[model samples]
Target: MALKMARDDLTEFLAAEFPQVAQDFVIEDVAENRIRVRLATQDRHLRPGGTVSGPSMFALADVGVYLAILAMIGPKALAVTTNCSIDFMRKPAAGADLIAECRLLKLGRVLAVGEVLMMSEGGDAPVARASLTYSIPPE
Candidate 1:
């Protein structure tokens, strides 16, 4: 499917609609039914054990799937997540960025579902995995 929003467009949309977190999340790439995003590592994201925090990883998965939907459906800021399930499989490397690879599994008139695999930047194994479903607001 042709992309409804490009990477730059999604970046700008995120910055405008979600200014507080815009800087931390970067739209790394966009592809058919998929999106790759990075969470720039920051001190605030650490959990004291020299590991990335759970909330931080959850945000990464949430935003990654959100943007993946927008990349295909256009920037619908009102689209809200209705369900999310995340698993923390391993400790993410401290002081390194986290990358989330999101794949949209289903998209319909009012709901979208996707999964995200998050890994430490330059690492081989995934630190977390998440499945999310979003409710697309009516037009």
Candidate 2:
């Protein structure tokens, strides 16, 4: 399906709906079935070893998939994650931003499945991978 929300639209939706952490993320790119999101890493997102925390990476994956779905289906705030499985493959680069490349694997009427590959900005290997399922709300 064609995207219903572009980067600007998604950015605005996030800022308006989730102001708390909206500034932490950036909608870098949006396309037919995929999105690239960046997490502007800060002190709060890091762990004791100066690497991005697991929870912070998970948040990036979750938000990445959520935005990709909204890009295809419009801003459906009610759409929620039903399940997620994330594997932290490696420690993120110290003090570097993180990026999530998300692809929508399936977009059904009531459900959507997406996969996210998380990486440290400018790094070669993936730091984490996640599979997520979201429940789309009824119209």
Candidate 3:
């Protein structure tokens, strides 16, 4: 499918609609069937053991898929997550940026489904995997 929004467009949309997290994440790349994003690791994202927290990883996955959907459907602020399933497979490296690769599985009028694989900045193996469903708002 053709893309409806590019990285700069999404960045502006997020800045206007979700200002709270606008500075935390960046849209790295957007393609026909894939998207790559990175989280600007911060102290608050760290756990007691100096690793990225689970919630942080989950957030990355969720937003990554959401952005991928919006990239196909255009900016829809009301598009909200309805369900998510995340699996933590390995420990993320401390002080390393986290990258999320997302692909859309299905995109319909009312719902969208996608998957994300998250890995450390320079790692080969995914540290976590997630599937997310979002409720697309009416036009």
TM-score of each: 0.98, 0.99, 0.97
Ranking by lDDT: 2, 1, 3
Query: Candidate 3, which segments miss by more than 4 Å at Cα?
Result: none
Clashing pairs in 1: none
lDDT of each: 0.93, 0.96, 0.91
State the lDDT at 24 in candidate 3. 87
> Which residue pairs collide in model 2, if any?
none
Task: Name the top TM-score candidate.
Answer: 2
The worst-scoring run of ten residues by lDDT in candidate 2 lies at 49-58
The 10-residue segment with the lowest total lDDT in model 1: 43-52
Measured on C-alpha atoms, candidate 2 has an lDDT of 0.96
Off by over 4 Å in 1: none
Error of 1 at 59 (Å): 0.4
lDDT (10s digit) by residue, model 1, range 1-139: 7899999999999999999999999888999799999999899999997788999999999999999999999978899999999989999988889999999999888999999999999999999999999999988
Worst 10 residues of 3 by lDDT: 31-40
Tens digit per residue, CA lDDT, model 2, 37-74: 99999999999989999899989999999999999999
Task: Give the TM-score (vs. native) of candidate 2.
Answer: 0.99
Best by lDDT: 2
Off by over 4 Å in 2: none
Model 3, 16-83: lDDT tens digits are 98899889899999997579989999998999988899999988998898889888999988899999
